[model samples]
Target: MAQQTASPDDSNGPESLYILGPFMFLGIVFFIVRIYTRLALSYKLNVSDYTNAVAVLAATITFGLFITAIVHGFGHHSFYITPEDSVIIFKCLYVVLTVGLFAAVFARISLACLCLQFTTSTVPKIILRAQIIFQIASLIATAVVTWIQCRPISAFWEAVPGGECFSPPQSWAFTATGIASDLVCAVIPILVISKLSRSLVERCLVCFLMAMSLFATAAGVLKIIYSYRFDRDPSDALRDMMPLFLWCRMEEVLLIIACEAPFLKSSIERVLRRMGLPVFQQKTKDLNSIHTFPDPRGSQGEAVKKDKGMKIDERKLEACEYTTSEDSTQSDESDGNSTRQQHGEVTDSSQSQPMSTPMDDV
Candidate 1:
């Protein structure tokens, strides 16, 4: 048995993956907390809501991979290429691809949930269904590609004594297909959102949701670029770990937050209002004042009629009081004949008289 030589491109050195691990773990924790809070507050937390479950599961898996990569990176000091090292690297790449595909599916589902909220028309419904079907097909394709990438799945991790693996180009092809599906999933939401009829505020909110898909797209692109670099030289350890694993983890974190943005926004608004912050006062005022008048012949007729008459009479009295108070204040201010206090008393009396009006039955 000969001592296997490490590849020349394998630069054994410290890398960014070690530093990214804990942060990715923290992101996973935060994602779980947010999801739990949301579920506790919601009417019923249904797994059938594919968006929520996918976001959560994707985050969990990504976090797990981040930890696995970190352990591998730290445990193996030599970033250089040994036959054993190549096995670990390829296994990590497999995990990265798996997490990326799951995250992409989750992102698409989240966007679909947003579309469902805004769209009621047949066309949008059909489009949404088509997107979902396409996503399912893409998932199946990616799964097949993943399994086929390594003929015997154990070859991906457990190195057979003399067994050969597929070339890097084959791996790259599978990766490229996964990335294409990711871009499709991300862009589809933006298209659906653009067709929706929404107020400026609502549109902005939906756009913000759609923008999250971009993170996943970027992750896919970064992974694709790095997959080529890794293929070119398997020994480029840092290149192999950082973009391939870190970006995918970051994408999962971002997707979780983005999917929960609407719930988070309302929670923040509620907290701010409780703290006496003037956030959304205008919107709140409009919402509070929106009311439908009762029909005269309905059960609410007596109360509605009384309210209407009282409103009219109060307005008339308020106008008369304002006129009298204005005249008295002007006279007092002009001649300097009346004491300021006495003039104020007269104005107050006139204004206060309206408060004493009787509200006997009509």
Candidate 2:
């Protein structure tokens, strides 16, 4: 990729900053809406559902803070010009690092929530526990790396005029850890959901939700790639890319919210209905009423009786038994009559036995 230099004038420029503001605003709104929806479904949902909501909230806050820091850093440059400007930039970088750490933690929790829905076996549970542990470790590592990225925290924002700063390796390690976590979270859902017992439609829906994790993975990759270039030149272009970083963070949080949307389908539909959208209302009502069974002995009893009568008659059983017995007796008598004739024929050879022969047979 070709490297583009970001002009100082572009820092907090009207256009770039303006566009990011609305997106950040919408992200905050979405996060609040998601929290409210989760609370509504809390009675029906499991612990994981609430956990996913919290994860999204954490990720949102992280991104929101990072965006604020970017705006602050860039906004400062809008009026002043000096090597000390790097100080403001580094402060923003610290905020980004802090947010990145939180984002990692939140992503892992969100993945755990997804895993809970599909897991039934002990092995999966163990794997989930391990993932959570690793996530915590990753968070701690990130925090430590960020703090050490700039020696003497005060030097991060105010130039000492001659002190040597640490290399970008610290930032690299932090970014690499986040990328690894994102990949883990993305792939874990595929494995877990694949083993779930669900209809094709249900499976597809879940797969789609799982697919949203790819956005996070993409963000991770972008962050890593951009971090590499930023490491080389840590310039204004890298700084302006803050919007992309904010987007990367926002994508993860939004995806977490999206994954949980199914749990709020009923509530969403209800809200839609109240707004006078008839189709959603009817569909939601229909789904809600599905478990209700009609009483056959009540209003539909006559219809049931009519259908049953068509397949069965009251006297058929009685007539069938009598006719079967009569047929059997007639068949026995015919056999007896034939045997008498045959005996008469045999008697002629045995010197004439009367045709009537006594009832006992000759």
Candidate 3:
């Protein structure tokens, strides 16, 4: 709770910073893994990847501002904050709103670009175009509301005798639009997957993967709900609205992660196998296998005898077939014995065609 019209004497408390820890830690880890998988493992990252990187950067700034605001009395009861401290916190809040809005917009745009990777259809392309246009429009609207919400802009930090400002309703409407955009982005992917001719389990799996965007949607909604406290008290608004600010950063971080997860199917399976869980076990064929033919100058009788005695063992080449990662053939320990046996057997036969590595990037 805030004290009524306090003097500018001192700042206090870091409770808000402590509250932001888990969300920041998890978001950073997810972003790092997604980047490593997209760049190191998948080998072809798109615009979505770059945009999400920017979003993560923006979210990190917002996270810092949350901590900065706390140091200036954000998490403290208003009595501890002076009028001078209130001014500083207000400036921090402005930065948070400006950067937080960008983080959300960039993340959704990244998600929109992600959807473009899947569909080559004309209709879906048009729908994606429409989504992009809406995104641009929403971005402009949010920016307008943010910068102009208070007249004589500095009035936002320190109230002016003659300055006028709009109510929170316009801001609420913009926040609501952001939350709706998150929901739409999430639902569109699920709807697209639902139309594919896939089994129930596969469809459910895809839908659930796409539905990870719901976490962002839920975060956006909560951000709006908590932001209502903004009008509660100017001196302590930053402390009171900490939950809203925290969720705002979380929305972008989670969206970046959830959007990239589907493409990391191979990477995730590789990790699971390393952890000793049976997953993506491949049965590879000895494509480097040899087929000895009778020498042009050799006798037919000798060739027949060699052919009659030589029989290829029925080995499971599982290691080579479904091992989608390029590094998997050498990195997989379980496949070591099979790979060695396959190579030794090939030595006993005549070298046929050179083997080619088979793989499909998801």
Candidate 4:
């Protein structure tokens, strides 16, 4: 539970800052690491990286607005703040909410773009493309409605004697839309990634990262609940709305972190390996690499003849080592040989292709 204020002058301003500042810093740290990992692994930045960049930038701006609001008497009751400072708080909140909405939308788009790299099927691609369009459209409508809820616009943050305004349904609708989109973004990965031909461990890792959207959805739900509370007793708006502010910020930054988490796996593994920590050994071969086998049903002592090897495209094998380490083939060769022998066949390890996984784009 949030700490309650004892009087109009008593506020949770400092507590809110303490909570939000570290999260914003952590989100920026992940963004820098994501960029660094891609460049270090010899991979170029793609659409997903660029979209997440915009999301993080928007989140940074929203955090700044949050700080500005807090400093201008945002957490105090109406009576404790001067009219001028109250107006400034309202103005900061308006921009904060609007920019935060974009941050979430772009984060969803970035995740969708990352999902696109893992799939090549027509139906899944179409679904992902549709999701992107729906998110972009919703963002535009919500932003426009938010600003136009009051006839004079400035009435949102100040007292306008003759201004007309809409009811609170816009806020409710925005929250519902955010929650619904987040659920879809979270579910799409599970459905699509489960059907991938990768090892069970690898598929589960990617799906777990993608499913982190549920955390953002949970935050959105909390925001709505707190919003209802604020609506009922708006006399102390700054105090009552503190939870709403915190939950909204959480939803935005969590989505961004979720989008970047999968990309950071390689860097994390590298760090662990450098620290002499034991990571999960890849005991399976790269599905995208070529493997040759020899027919074991030959005459005794006859020279072994290799069967035709599966031809792999050279371009497809040029992925980052995070997806498939070149050293994995050498380590797992014995396991491969034993498996083939159980199936009454022999593999030619000398003809194995350089390790490269299909999920490198992830």
Clashes of each: 0, 0, 10, 0
Q: Give the winner by lDDT: 1 or 3.
A: 3
Which portions of model 3 miss their true places by more than 4 Å? Answer: 1-16, 194-206, 228-238, 275-362
1-362 in candidate 2: lDDT tens per residue? Answer: 12332333445434544654564465456555655665554535455545555565566565555555555454333234355555565566567657656655665566665565556667767767786777677677767766776566666666566544575465566556555655655566567555544334444555565555566567667766655555323334444455556545655554464445334444544666799864221111111100101332232222224333444333432222222245554664554421123211111122222233111110
Root-mean-square deviation (CA) per prediction? 14.6, 21.6, 10.2, 10.2
Model with the higher lDDT, candidate 2 or 4: 4
Per-residue lDDT tens digits for candidate 1, residues 1-362, read 12223434332223454555554555456556556655666645533245656656766775665555455542242343355655665576677667666765665666555555545567766766676676667667776777776657776666676544565354455445545544554455456555543334544554565456566567657767665555422334444445555655655565555555444444555677899875432111111111122222232222224333444333333333222356666775565433234322222222221221000000
- What does candidate 3's lDDT look like per residue over 1-362, in tens digits? 33344445433334445545676676677777777777775687778888878878888888787777777777565666678988888798889888887777787788778776656567866877687788778778878887887888998888798887676466677667667766766777777766554445545665676667888888777877777656654545545666666676677667766766565556666777799976642233332333222232222222223444654432432222333344654554344323233322212222222232111233
Consecutive 10-residue window with the lowest summed lDDT within model 2: 283-292
Maximum-TM-score candidate = 4
TM values, all candidates: 0.58, 0.59, 0.68, 0.76
Residue pairs in collision within model 3: 7-82, 8-82, 8-83, 282-318, 282-319, 283-317, 283-318, 284-317, 284-318, 284-321
Q: lDDT of all predictions, in order shown?
A: 0.51, 0.51, 0.64, 0.74
lDDT of 4: 0.74
